[model samples]
Target: MSTQFLKLVQATRVPPLMGPKKRAASTAEHASPLGAYLLDARAISPGNLAKALALQLREDARLGDILIANGWVTERDLMMALSAQYGIGFADTALPPHDLDMIRSVPWELCLQYTVVPWSQTGGMLILATSNPDKIPQIRAALPPGLGNVLFTLAPEVEVLKAIALGHGKALARRAEAKVPERMSCRNWATSLSSLVVPTLCIVLIFNLLFHTTMTLAVLSLLACALLISNVIFKGTALWFHLTEDKSEFHSHRDHGSQTKRPIISLFVPLFKEPRIAGPLVQRMARLDYPRELLDICLIVEEHDIETRMALARAAIPSWFRVIVVPDGTPRTKPRAMNYALNFARGSIVGVYDAEDAPEARQLHAVANRFAIAPKKVVCLQGRLDYYNPRQNWVSRCFTIEYATWFRLFLPAIKRMGLAVPLGGTTLFFRRDVLRELGGWDAHNVTEDADLGIRLARLGYETEMVDITTHEEANAATWPWVKQRSRWNKGYFMTWVVHNRQPIQLLRDLGLRKWLGFHMMFLGMILNAALAPLLWSTVVVAFGMHHPIMTLLPEWAVWPMALVFTLATVLTITLALVACRASHLRFLRLWVPLTLPYFQLTTLSTYKALFETVRKPFYWDKTEHGAFGGAEHDVQTPEAAGIERKPVIFGTPIKDTAPNIQALPDQLTKVPVIKVGTDGTIRRIS
Candidate 1:
C-alpha cells in the first residue's frame, strides 16, 4: 500500500515483448490491465517472479512441502537476480519476443509470485495479472516441479484462485485472512486511581473546600487540564508512528477486476531557496505507486529561485513530475508556495512534503493501503518525521526525543481525543479533490500544517496515520538549532493567529473537550515553553537539597507559597513524565532532573520567535550542522543513543547563494575575491 511509492526501481533492463499466443481460456493480444500497466504480456520478468516465489516458499513450512520443494523451478529466479546483481552472465537479451508466445492480463507482481519467469530460453512469456499480488507467491512457491516458470497469472480472482488450487496444494482454498480491528484498547492505564489519581483528586477537593475558590484552585485546574490534553496529543503521534511501521491496508485489497483500486493522488514538494534538495527529491518521483501518467508530482519553487528550476531540469523528469515556479511577490513562505502548487496539481488525492525529505521507501504504499481500508472517511495521512542523524549533539538528541514523542504519541492521541493534528513539514499525503474542496493550504497562516489539519476537521474528513516515516537531517550546530527553532515557534504563533480568525466556527465544530485539547497541545506548547523559567524558578529552590531551606516570609506567608509552588511542580513533573514515557525514553529518566533546569532554556527560543514575528513572520531559520561536533557523527546503523549526524548537507549557507550548488553550472573553483587591477579574471582575494 505505498499510498504513494514504496520503491522506484529504475528498470533499465526490460526486453522486447514476445509475440502473442492464444490462451485456451482468453485472448492474449487485448485485455484491459486491471491494476497497473505492468500487467501487459511484455512486462513480467520470469526471473523476478521465480525469485519472489522462492522467497515465499522458504518461509511457509506448510507450503514448503509442495512441488517447489521437489525442484520445481529450483530457485531459478533467486539465482537470476544474484547473477544479474553480480554481473554474472547478464546477457543482452539474445532471445526475441516474436519467437515466443506472449501471455497477457497478468501482472508483473503475479509473475514473480508463481515463478513465471518473464525472459526465458523457452518460447513464451507468462504474465500474472491478479489485483492481489500477495497471493501470487503463495501459490507459486508450492507448484509441482513440471510447471516450472510456465504459468501465467490472471486478473480475475476466481480464475486465479482456481489456477492456484490446481497448481498449488488445496491449503490456500481453506484460508481466509482476518481483517484488522479498527481500534485497539489503551495499553497503559493512566486513568487508574490507585497509583496517584485518587490521592491527587482528594487533595484537590479538600483544598477547594478549605480555600473556597482562589488563584491556587485556578492553577490546579490548569495542571489537571494539561495532563489530560497532552495525553491525547502524545497518543495520537505514537499511533501514527506504529501504523507506519506495520503493514498497510492499501496493499490488502484483492482485485478480481473490482473498480476500486485506482484513486488519483497529487504530490507536492515546496522549496523556497533550496536548490540543493530539489533534484534528489524530484528524482524520487519514479518510485510512486500510482500510475506514472495519472500522478502529478509538483515541484513548487520560488519565482526568483532560478537555481532550483535549473536543478530540476537537470534531471529532465517526465511530464508527470512537473515544476511550478511560483511568481515572486510579498509573503514568501512555505504555505505561499504550497498555495501556488495546489493551483496546478491534478489528481484525486493530494500530498505535500518538504524538499529535504526522503521518506520510507514504502511511505506512499502505506498511505494507499491505509486509504483503501478506511476509505469512507480517511482522506489524509500525516507521516512522522525524525532526523536520521538526530544525535549530532545534546540539542539534536533532545529534538529527536521531542519529535518522537510529538509525532508518535502526542498527535495521534490528540486525533483520538477528537482534536486536529498539526502535521510535520514533510510526507503529508492527501486526496487531491478533497484538498481543493477545502481550498488548499492557507495563504495567510504561517504553520500551514496545523491550520490545514484544523481545516480538515472542520470539513468532517478524518485523517489516519499511514505506516510511514521520513528521514531528515537535524540542524548541525547550536546557532543553527536556535535559529531553526525560532522559525518554528514563530509559525506556531502565526497559526494561533489565523485559526482564531474564525473562532465561532471552531468552537461549534470542535466542541468543548476537543477544543480544550487543541488549545493545550498547540497553545499550551507556546505558553509553557515560553514561560517555564518564571513558573519553575520558585520550585527549584525547594527541590534543591544543597540550598539552605530558609523561611524568609513570616509564618502566615510561607504556607501558601509552599502549597502553590508544590502544585506547579506537580504540574511540571506530571507533563514531563508523560512526554518522556510517550517517547519510550526510559533511559532519560535519570536526565529528567537534569533536563528540568534546561526546560526553561527553551524559553529563549520562544522570546526570539516572538520578537521576530513582526519583522520576519515567515523567516526560514536555518539550522546549521556540525556544532557540538568533533569527529564525524555518521554511523552505518542507527543508534539508540549517541551523537548522530548525516555527514552530507546540501545548499549554501542560508545567507549566501552565490557560491553554493546554485552555482553548479559555473566553472569557478574558488571566489576571485577582489578585482584589484580591473583585469577580468585573475585576482584572488587572499
Candidate 2:
C-alpha cells in the first residue's frame, strides 16, 4: 500500500517518460497540443483527460495538477509534452558550477514564491527552470530589473522544489555561518572573561582582602547572604504561585472540538551516536496517535555519523519518516542540525524531541488543540519532561527530583504568573511562522531552548505550558551525570551572559517583575550552585567542627547567619516534596533528606562547567545512555524501573494507573506493562 501511494505521489510530481522512439512516434502522430498529444500518446486515458479538463475549468490550478491528482498523467509526461509543444529544453537536475552566481542574481523570496530557480547565465540570457513555464512573464516581472533577457525551460516539479530547497538552504547556511560566534559560540572575549577570568579574579581578590581587612570579610559575607536570601525568596514565591494558582485552567485532556482539522506537525529528532537506542526511538515515535499523512518526522543525523545513520537504516521505520543529513559545519550541535532541518519542515507546527524521548501518544494532538484555541501571540508550548529511568541509580533519582521540581512546579508557576519561562530542550512545539520569524534556534548557543524562550519574551511572544510529559533517559552514572549537568550549567551561564548583554534594553523589554525573575532564574541559579559549597564548608567548619572562623564575625551576624541557613534548608526540602507531588513522583520524596549531598554533586559540575566554558566553550559533552542501573538491578524498562504514570488534578495525584494503551505493529511499539499496588507503589507486571 505504501509503495502504491508513493508511486502515485511521485508520478504527479515527476512522471516516468517513455522510450525516445515511442515518444517521437506519438509526437509526430499527434500535433494538436499538450492534452491531445498526451491522450493520443496514451500517457493519460480519455476518461481521466476529460475529468481533468472539467475540474480545471472550475479550479485555479493548472491542468497538469488536476491530471496528476486524478492519476491520469504523470508530471514527467506532462512536462515532456509541454516542453515539446513550447519548443523548450527539459532542465537537468545536475546543478551547474555557475549556479551560485545565478542564485545570487535573484532574491531568495522571489525564487521560493515563484517555484523558479535560476539555472545558468550565458552572454545575454539568464536561464531558469520552472514547472510552470507558462508563468515566464510573471517570473521575469518578479526578478530585479538589472538582469538581461529571461529564458524559461521545463523541469519536473520535484526537481524545481529540490533546487529551491538547495538554493535557499545554502543562502541560509551562509547567513548562519556568519552569525555562528554571536549565536552559538562562547569564544568571544566578553563571555570568556565573564564565565572564567572574572570569577577567578574575584575569588583571588576576596581571599586577599579577607586576610587584610575585617570590613572586606564583612562585606563578602553580607553579599553571600544577599544572594542566598534572593534565591530563597525566588523559590518561595514560585512555590506560593505553584500552590495557590488555580490548576483547573490547565487541562490535561485534549479538546477534541478544537481539532476540526488535523494540521501537519513536523517532529525533529537530532541524533549523534547511541546506535543502541535507534530501534527504540523509532518504535516510540511510531506510537504517536496522529494521522500518518499529517505527521512529518525528520530524524536529523550528522553527515559524518555513519553508525547512527546505519542504525536508523536497519530500524523498521515507516515510509513517512524522513532522515535529514546535516552538512558538516562549525559549532556542530543539536540546534544547528535542527536549524538545517527547519527549511524542509512541511508542517504549520514544528516540534523538537531528543533521540531518547518517549512523549505521550496524543502529545501532538493536545499541542494542536492548544494552538487552535490559543491567540496568535502565543507562539510556543512547552511540555513537561521527566526521566523514565529515575530509580536506575542514586544520581538518576536525584536528577529526576530536580527535573520534577523545575518542570512541574517552577515552569508552570512562571507561566501562570506571566513571566518568561525558560524552555526545556525536548518536547517543545512552536508555530512554524513565528519560529522562522525568530530565525529558528541559535546554532551557536549551548542552551538554545532557554535562550529562545528569553528571546521570545523579549520579542513580545508568550509561551504556555502544556500538561503533557515526555520521558527521557536519566544520566545514571556519576561521571556522565556530571558531564550532562556541566553542559547544562555552562549553557545557563551562557544564556545569562547573552541575554544580559544589553541590560537596559532587556529591563525595558521585560518589566521589572519579569526582569528580576529572569535574573533569579539564570544568574541566581548559577550563583547558588557555585557558592553552595563555600557556604556549606563554612557552616561545617564553624558549627560541625567548632572552628574559629565564627569568632571573626560580629556577634549579631551569627544569629542571622544561622537563621538564613535554617530557612534555606527548610524551604528547599518543602519545595522538593511539593514538586514531587505535583509531578506524580511522590515516592521519590523520600530522597529529600539527601538534597544537600545531591546539590554538592551540582557544585562539582558547576566548577567543571566554569572551567570548560573558558577552555572548550562550545564543546558538547555527550551523555551516554543505556546504562540503566548499578549492581542491585540490571537495565529495565520504565515499568521494571518502578515508575508510574498518573494524572494530576489540582496539584494532587489521583490513585489510578491503568496504562493508556494504543495498539501498533509489534516492531513499531514497545510500551512496558506496569501495575499499581494498593500502597500506591508502581511495579512491573511481568
Candidate 3:
C-alpha cells in the first residue's frame, strides 16, 4: 500500500528538463507572476492576492510564502502552482522512496538547512525533492561535484519533512543530542566525576588533619562569611543601580518608530507530560498581537509523550501553529527537543516559551521593534517573566517577589555592568544565526539557558534585558517548588563546571571584570544557597540563644560578623521590597520580611541539588504546569484585578481576552485530525 501510494504521488511530479544544467528563471519570473496564475486558477481571491502583495512589499517575502502564511491558499496548491510556473514536477501527498546513496551524497545538516532530500535516480539524473524552491540554487551550489546531473521537484513541506524524518531521523536525533562541542559539554561528567572530586576531598581532608579541628572550623567559617558578604554586596550594587536607572532610555524605546518591517518570529514551546495545558496554551498563544500570518509556533513534544500529543490533537490548533514531535533520544531535555525542532523552525528570530506562558499581547511587536533597532552584536533579548497566580499561596507570593527581584533589578544591573546575563528559560528571543552558531544549547546541561548565556559572552555577543513581561503559572505547592529550584541549582553547578574547565581561556574570553562577575553569579549563588544555614545560625545570637559557632570565633570577630549579617539581611529585604514595588505588586509588600525564612527552603534545595549533581546531573526535574486554575477561573483581564495601565516595558499591558475553548467530542470529532504517531511523525488525517 505504501509503495503504491508513493508511485501515485510520484506520477504528479514534473521532473526538471533533461540536461546537465537547468537554466535560471527569466527576469519576468522574479516579478512573482505566480499571483496571477493563482488568481486564474481561482485558488486565491483577488483581494487576498492584493493583501499578500502589499505584505510582500513590506516584508520583502515570496508571494507564495505570504499567501500560504495567510492561509489564503493551501500549501499543496501553492506548490502545484509553483511547479507549473517553474516547469518543475510537483511531489504530491507523500514523497517517493528515498535513495540511500543519493541521500548520503549530501551532508545531513545541509539537507535540514535547505529542507531538501534526494528522492531517486532515473535516466542518469538524480532527482532532488524540496519544499522550498528558493533554496534550490543554494543546494545546487553545495552539492558534491561527481553528482553530475540533478533535477528538482517541488513538494509540500510536510511531505518533504516526513521523507527526511523517515530516512534520517536517528542520525539527526543523535546529532541533536550532542550539538555542543565535547569540551564545552558536561555530558561526559560521569567519566570525570571522580577525577574532579577526589583531589578536592583529599586536600580538605589533609587540611583537617594538619590543623586543629577548631582552627579548621574557624577558617571554614571565615571563608563562608567572606563569600556571603561578597554575594550580598553584589546584590546590593545591582539593587542600587535598579533604583537609580534613568527612565529616559526606556522612554525613547517606547517612542521609537514602529515602522520597521517586522520579520516572521518563530517560537518553540517544548512540552513533556503537559497534556493539561495544551488547550490553555493555544488560547494563550492566540492572544499574541502579531499578525497571524507571520506567527510560526511549534509546540514540541517528546515522541513518547502521547498524552500531550493527544491533548494537542484535540485542540483547535490555529493554522499558524504546528505540532512538532521530537524523536526520542538520550537526556530527553527541553534543550535537546528544541535542538531537534530547530531544524523545522521557519523564522529568522526564534524565541522560547513554556507550556503555561501567557505573554502580554504586544510582546512580540516589542521584540521585533527592539531587534530592529538593536546593534548586530546584541544577539539576545531576555524579557521579564512574572506569575499570574502569585496570589495562589504563600509559596507563590514569595516566588513572585523573588522573580521581581531577579528580572527587574538583578538582571538589569548585570546587563548594565556588561556582565553576562543568565537567560531565563522562557521569554527569550535570539538571532537564529547566532543561536545556531552557538550550537543551540547544551543538551546535557540542565540549565541550558544559563549555560548558553555564558557561551554568548564567551563568543563576544551581548544579551540585553527587555522590559516586556510574560505572565506564567508559578509553582504554588511546596514539594514541587523544591524540585524545581533544585533542578535550577543543579544546572547552575553544571554550568559553572563546564565553563570553568579551562579557567584561563574563559578568563580571556569574558575579561577580568566579567570573569569576576561570572564567579560571583554562579559560584556565589551556589554558596549562598549551600551555606545559607551558616549565616542563618548567626541570627540566634540576636535572640540571645547559645550557638555552637561562638566557641570558634574570637571576640573581635563576633561584632564584625554580626554587623555583616545584619547588613546582608537589610540588603536582601530592601532589594525585594524595591522590586516588588517596581512590579506594582503592592499586596505582596507585607510578605517581604518573611523572605529570609522563605529562602531557607533553597538551602534544602541546595542539598538536593548537590546530591543530584553527582547522581543524576542530566536529569530534567520536570515541573508540572496548569496546577492552578488561571485565566479561566480568575477575572478575565489585568484591569479586573485593579492593576493600573503603565509601561512595564514600552506599552500599556493589554487585556487578556480569553480564547473560545469549548471542548470537542472524544476522538476529536469536530476538529481537524493532526495525528502524531509514536515514531514522532505528524500526519494531517482530515
Question: Which numbered prediction scores highest in lDDT against the true structure?
Answer: 3
Q: After the best TM-score superposition of candidate 2, give how far the Cα of residue 83 lies from its true spot, in angstroms.
A: 11
Q: Where is model 3 more than 4 Å wrong at Cα?
A: 1-30, 94-106, 120-126, 134-137, 145-148, 193-195, 202-211, 258-260, 540-554, 582-584, 630-686
Clashes of 2: 3
Local distance difference test scores for all models: 0.47, 0.70, 0.75
In order of appearance, the predictions have TM-scores of 0.52, 0.73, 0.85
Those runs of model 1 whose alpha carbons end farther than 4 Å from true positions after fitting are 1-259, 283-291, 315-320, 540-598, 618-686
Ranking of models by TM-score: 3, 2, 1
Candidate 3 residue lDDT tens string, 207-316: 89586666665555666788988977898789878878986766454356554556778999999998888887887776676665567899999899999999999988
- Model 1 lDDT tens row, 1-686: 11111112223431112112312111232221110112122233222222222222222111111212323223233223222222223212222122122222233234334433222232432333332333545755654444446432222222333233233211211111101111110101123221243246458868875876544444543453344345444544445443454333323422112223434466887776565555556544444433333356777777678877777778657545666666565456666667555544445667787666655543554565456556566668887776656545565566656666566556655566567777776778777667666656655345667767766776677876554677666665556667777777766766564455457777787677666666765767777676454344444545542211223223354355566555555544444455556343555544444445444556778888776655555556654322333113231122222212111001011122233222322422332222112211112232
lDDT of 2 by residue, 603-667 (tens): 88888988876777788988765556211123234354444432222112233322231211121
Worst 10-residue lDDT window, candidate 3: 658-667
- Compute the lDDT of residue 501 as modeled in candidate 1: 48
Candidate 2, after superposition: displacement of residue 550 in Å?
4.3
Clashes of each: 56, 3, 1
Which model, 2 or 3, shows the larger lDDT? 3
TM-score of 3: 0.85
Candidate 2 residue spans exceeding 4 A from truth: 1-109, 112-140, 144-171, 178-219, 259-262, 540-553, 582-584, 627-686
